[model samples]
Target: MKALAGDLGIETAVSFPGRLTTDELSSLLGTAWINLHFSVAEGWCLSVMEAAAAGVPTVAYEVPGISESVVPGTSGLLAKDGDIGDLTNRVTEILHSPQHWWASSRRVVESRGWDRVAEDWERYLTVVFSSA
Candidate 1:
């Protein structure tokens, strides 16, 4: 990754914080303007949710699990998997426009929270248990 970044003339910072506590992770996420996720597949991306909670938008490929978290043009923009150009364009688009960037951040903040998730699960579980 470092070599690729250098070849592209992009500056890179490599940190090997092997493990981090939740608080440490939150603090790190809070400082980021955007999170870039390039995974081919994921069941659920806790990192993406964490980034959203920190009011940082994400840029990721439009894959199944990732798509659910990052709604294109809402929480973040999505590019076709393996399309580096599209991904680069999307990132540039968001970073170049403050209005778009803040709008996406606002959407993420307004859309989900731990309280909301718990309430949703509680409601669903209540129905399931009652039916049983």
Candidate 2:
């Protein structure tokens, strides 16, 4: 992780192997200057959601679940899907611009949040419970 972070010209930290706790991870994410995830495929990115909840600005590759997770130019910046250069450019854009950072912080909180997710879940559960 450190090597990759270094290669990307960013600072990195890791949790104890096989002992990665969500709260611990969230704490680390909370302190991050910026949270970035460049995965090629994701069914659903809980990490991005968590980072947004932590009020951490995020940068990620624009892919299937990613678009749903990170609201581009708001909660986080997304590189053109399948374009590495675009990813790099988006990251650079966010890192260099202070206004973008503040905007992202607010966007993440307002848009992508567990509160909203939980409400959705609750609605679904309510329907299920009513049927039961």
Best by TM-score: 1
Local distance difference test values of all predictions, in order: 0.79, 0.74
Candidate 2: where is the Cα deviation over 4 Å? 1-18, 98-103, 106-132
Per-candidate TM equals: 0.74, 0.66
Q: Candidate 1 regions off by >4 Å? A: 1-12, 98-103, 106-110, 118-132
lDDT score, candidate 2, position 21: 84
Candidate 2 Cα deviation (angstroms), residue 25: 2.1
Residue 47, candidate 1: Cα error in Å is: 0.7
Per-candidate clash tally: 0, 0
